[model samples]
Target: MSQRLVVGITGATGAAYGLRLLRRGRELGLETHLIVTPAGVLNVHHELGLDRKALEAETSFSHAPGDVGACVASGSFATAAMVVAPCSMKSLAAIAHGFGDNLLTRAADVTLKERRRLILMVRETPFNLAHLRNMTAATEMGAIVFPPLPAFYHRPQTIDELIAESIERVLELAGVAGAAPKAWTGL
Candidate 1:
């Protein structure tokens, strides 16, 4: 698999997931390309106290959300996968309907069209019919709707641990070797 991973951060509440994904990708030696929506920057700042610059610094390269001409927006740009952490419902809808109004969704569309993995860490509660249907649509189109839900099998003590575990699982799904979370050996 290519070492290039494209990551998108939307306006969802869980900006930390995107941040941690970038950090982990770097540690795992993956070249991460990031695209943060305008609202995504707001959430990152509000939740993690980091500005757009700080968030962009975490990746190997950063592209503006509106940059449709970016390398990541092309199917020829060999990438291992594209993951949208904290994917907003709006973004999900856009991706599901093939609306490449911005680079982030365009990259995701390219990933799907290229038959590469596209994981969406959707963040929302009490899903409406539209959200569920959109998720279904995306799934049918080969996008994995992976919500950033925490797991408790490891008995995590801190929020960071939970996030780490989730990210590890995501990385494993993204085809990153040695990224599997701790296995359950049984009680």
Candidate 2:
């Protein structure tokens, strides 16, 4: 199977999720292709203090959001999966509707069309009707709408632990071997 993983970072609050996923993907030997929306850049800098250059350094390849011609925008690119960590509701709407307005959404569209796993770690709370509807649409189109809610069962002592365990579960859903999250045992 192809080892390529496409990761999209949007203008969501939880930029840490995207960063950790990139780091873990590197450790797992996946060729990571990153697409960060302009707002995503701002959030990464604001949340993680990482500039675009520093963030790009985390991945094997990085594409501009406007670069719809990038390799990952095509279904022929042969990526194993695509994930939008901290996916914005706007992005969810675009992907749900096959808008493909930019490289991130285009790659997601391709992932769906190719029958590859597409996980969206959406980061929003107190959803409105539109958010719920878009999520349903994305799910109907074969996208896994994963909200990055922490699992309290893990009894994480640190914020890092919560983020780490959540990301492990996401990586597992992306089909990464050995990316298992801590299993929940019967109480």
The deviation in Å at residue 103 for candidate 2 is 0.2
lDDT of 2 by residue, 1-187 (tens): 4489999999999999999999999999889999999999999999999999999999999999999999998887898899998899999999999999999999999999999999999988899999999999999999999998889987899999999999999999989876979999978
Native-structure RMSD, model 2: 1.0
TM-score of 2: 0.98
What candidate 2 gets wrong by more than 4 Å, as runs, is none
lDDT against the true structure, each candidate: 0.94, 0.94
**Angstrom error at residue 66, model 1:** 0.9
Clashes of each: 0, 0
Summed over model 2, clashes come to 0
lDDT of 2 at 3: 88
Residues 1-187 of candidate 1 have per-residue lDDT tens digits of 4399999999999998999999999988899999999999999999999998889899999999988999999998999889999899999999999999999999999999999999999999989999999999999999999998888878999999989998998998989876868888998
TM-score of each: 0.98, 0.98
**TM-score, cand. 1:** 0.98
Q: What is the lDDT of residue 97 in candidate 1?
A: 99
